[model samples]
Target: MKTAVALTIAGSDSGGGAGIQADLKTFAFNYVHGASVVTCLTAQNTKEVTEVMAVSPNMVKAQFEAVINDIKVDALKTGMLFNQEIISTVADCIKSWGGDNIVIDPVMVSRTGAQLIDDSAVEVMKRELFPQALVLTPNIYEAQLLSCMSIHCLEDMKQAAAKIYDLGAKTVLIKGGAAEGKNKGIDVFFDGQGYTIVGIKAIDTVNNHGTGCSLGAGITAHLALGKSLPRAIASAKEYVTTALEYSLEIGSGCGPIGHFFPLIESQYNG
Candidate 1:
């Protein structure tokens, strides 16, 4: 049987919890072959991101071209393109490739609410990339930024999802993981016509370092395997929830969810 291939154009996490590392693990667990184009390098662990250095725009283009030319990417996701130059380069490559099955995770805000990219890069992403996205997955903070409103409740999240849908993405998923109150762990999905509320029992754990990245990657992998957008999102949500249940207490700070939880479970049982 032929294998499906998914690609991740993101950054390298020295911590092995987020970005490219998390993305590849998600893809592998889904039984999809994973390819990567590293957009930036970060020197930090699960605790904090200390230093970040972006790959040159030319190199970003080269990496994207090399992978797209050789492998037939069934689906692809973009993570931390740190600058306007890199975002432009990636958007241009996708346009040139006439790429579809695109999942865009707007990684603008950190888990601690720090701004990761500058305002200018955010503008570039909105203008160049969002329109091309098959699904735009943004956490609550990012959703607030994009929709120009604060989200404090499920209603607010639904409003934000609708507003973001106007930004040209065919579908928008506003992650409420960081939300307070009873609605936490509930995500609002908007796909032009209507909204779907997806909720899972919230797992209490601090070791959710790559939940967003892994969720987006899992969706991409399922899309690569020929699932519909809603099915892909649902499956990915279940996967992330299970991964969170098996969250690894690896680092001193916030650790990472177990991307390979089934394997770990089997090993322990055996």
Candidate 2:
């Protein structure tokens, strides 16, 4: 059987929780070959991101060229594009090489609702990158920034999803993980036709450091493996839920979900 291949253009998490680490793990589980172009290097653990150093635009372009020329990338995901220059470079490369299955995880806001990048980067991403997205996955805070609306309820999330879809992505998934209510983690999906809400009963855990990255990577992996967009989203949601259910308590602060829980469990049980 032939294997699928996926690429991640994202930052590197030194702690191996989110970013390229999580993306590779997710791709591995889906039986897809994983490739990466590191956009930034961050000194972060489960606790917090203390420092970030972005790669040069030329280096970013070099990596993109190396991957595209050698590997047949079935799908790709972007995370933590730190600045306008990097965003523009990536967008140009995608346009040049062609981007069919691009999953854009707008990593603009942190878990605590803090802006990670500036407005200029966000503006550049929207203008240059969003149009290339086959799928756009943004958490609550990111959705708010993109739609310029406060999401207090599920209906609000639906509205945000529509607005974001209008921004150029063929499909928009507004993650409601941060939304407050009885159903605290409902994800709204809009594919230019209508809306669908995907939710698993929220798992209470502080060890969710890489949930967004993992979710987006999983979807990308499935897409590479020939799954439909909606099926990929549903499967990715389930994968994240399971990872959260067996989340790893690694560091002093918020840790990472167990990307390989099922694999480990199988190994141990057998």
Candidate 3:
């Protein structure tokens, strides 16, 4: 039998926590073959990002062509596009390839709420890449930036989702993981017509280093497996929650969620 393929266009995380690393792991767990095109490289660990070096736009374009020409991608996700040039290159390539089933994880800010890319890059992504997305997944802060709205509650999340949906994406999911109160970790999904609140009990852990990447990749993997948007999101939600439950406290600061929690559990049990 042939396996579904998922592609991740993103940066390299030396810590093996986020970016392409997380995406591939999520793909593997979902029984999909994972491919990647690295836009940049980050010198960081579970603690913090120390330095970043981006690949040339030409190089990024080459990688994309190499993969798409030979392999068949059922679903594709973008994460941590470092600059405007890379964003434009990726957007152009995706357009030329006629690739759909896109999951865009607008990774402008870190989990700890630190800005990762410049405003110019963010602007380029909003203009060039966002409209092409089948699903746009943004955290509360990212949603706020994209929607230009304040999100303090579920109602605000819904409003933000609608606002982001207006930006050309067919669907939008505003993640409320950082929201306050009892209803934290809720995600508002807007499918151009209605809303679905995806929620689970928020886990309190410092090992949430790659939550966004993992969730986005998980959704992409499910989509590659021919799941509907709503079903894909639901499966991705459960996958991420379980990974969080088995998160690793390997470093001093924020660590990474266990991308292969079930595999690890089975190995230990055996």
lDDT (10s digit) by residue, model 3, range 38-133: 999999997778999999999999999999999999999999888899999999988887867999999887655777788998989988998999
Of 2 and 3, the candidate ahead on lDDT is 2
| lDDT against true structure, model 2 | 0.92
In terms of lDDT, the best-performing candidate is 1
Off by over 4 Å in 1: none
**Candidate structures ordered by lDDT, highest first:** 1, 2, 3
Error of 1 at 112 (Å): 1.6
Q: Which stretches of candidate 3 lie over 4 Å from their true place?
A: none
What TM-score goes with each of the models? 0.99, 0.98, 0.97
Q: What lDDT does the true structure give each of the candidates?
A: 0.94, 0.92, 0.91
What tens-digit string does per-residue lDDT give for candidate 2 at 1-270?
A: 888999999999999999999999999977899999999999998777799899999999999999999888999999988999999999999898785899999999976899999998999999999999999999999999999999888888888898999899989998877777675778999999989889878998878888999999999999999999999999999998899988998889888989998877899799
What does candidate 2 score on TM?
0.98
